[model samples]
Target: MIVLFIVLGGLLWLISLLLFAFSAWASYKLMRLLWGKIRRALLRPGTAQITSYEVFTPDPEDIHVQDTRPQIRLELDCERHGQRFQVSLGPLTCEELFPALDLPAHHIACWLSDEDWRQLLEKRWVTIACDWRLRKAILTSQIRNDRRLLLISFLSLSLFALTVTLSLLPH
Candidate 1:
């Protein structure tokens, strides 16, 4: 009886260790995601006029870079707090998270629609959400679906965690 009790306890301890490792990984990923958002929020928001942009599509004929997506290169003139600067950003790539199965279209952030891409090209202006401290600039357009996708990711992760927790309980 004592031996059986010890074996059960060891199994439970092993399971707990696995759970701890998984939880730590999840927390690390969450923290990294949240930290990026916080950093972006803290930065001063500014819009940079897209002075010029060039779209580069990798040669489909070349096997070397055929699988690569299109890249957008931009020259931006940004002004913030009476200080104006010109910066170049690219080759920017966008991919949507949940892409439609039927379409062959390339997406930025895995969600940017064909129409949005067209407008971005035609409008010749983009919102510059940049981190000056990092010397990096991110050009973005508003998309409602982006937020929905983020929510979905969180919910899915939470659901997975719940499932694991439930399975660990005595049945």
Candidate 2:
């Protein structure tokens, strides 16, 4: 019975180490894609038209805090070319747009920027040159606030140490 516990713990510890390694590799790749690949790309377009926009919020599991990231979808008008496209940027917070937010939230509608919305509304066409793949953004966010990940790392190390100590004990 004791041997089974030790073996299971050892396996989990090894798995956590592999997971940590993968996370590091993924983070490195995401940063490279976000900055290195698009260093010269323009973040904003000279002209953009906001035909429509909608804000979305998922059901909150707890009253204390929201669960899902807030998102907004914008349908842009391409008047000069005669085609329409949609662009979205979300899971935003006050820190992303204005001076700062008192608390950081994964979801903030439009970064609470009326001026930004006005800018989009004023223009008849819009373009985004430097937007990254959604996958990259998700990975970046995971790395930014990885509480569960850190916990797993610590647990893994402790398990490893415990397994070593157990093996050293008398049979």
Model 2 CA lDDT for position 134: 34
**TM-score, cand. 1 vs. native:** 0.47
Q: Residue 40 in model 1: shift from native, Å?
A: 3.3
Q: Considering every candidate listed, which one attains the maximal TM-score?
A: 1
Compose the digit string of candidate 1's lDDT tens values, residues 1-171.
999999999999999999999999999999898767656555554566767667667788887774467666777777766866777777655442111111344544434455665555553655565555565665433223334556687899999999999999999
The candidate that wins on lDDT is 1
Q: Which ten residues in a row have the lowest lDDT in candidate 2?
A: 130-139
- Score candidate 2 by lDDT: 0.48
**For candidate 1, what is the lDDT?**
0.62
RMSD of each: 9.7, 12.8
Residue-pair clash count for candidate 2: 5
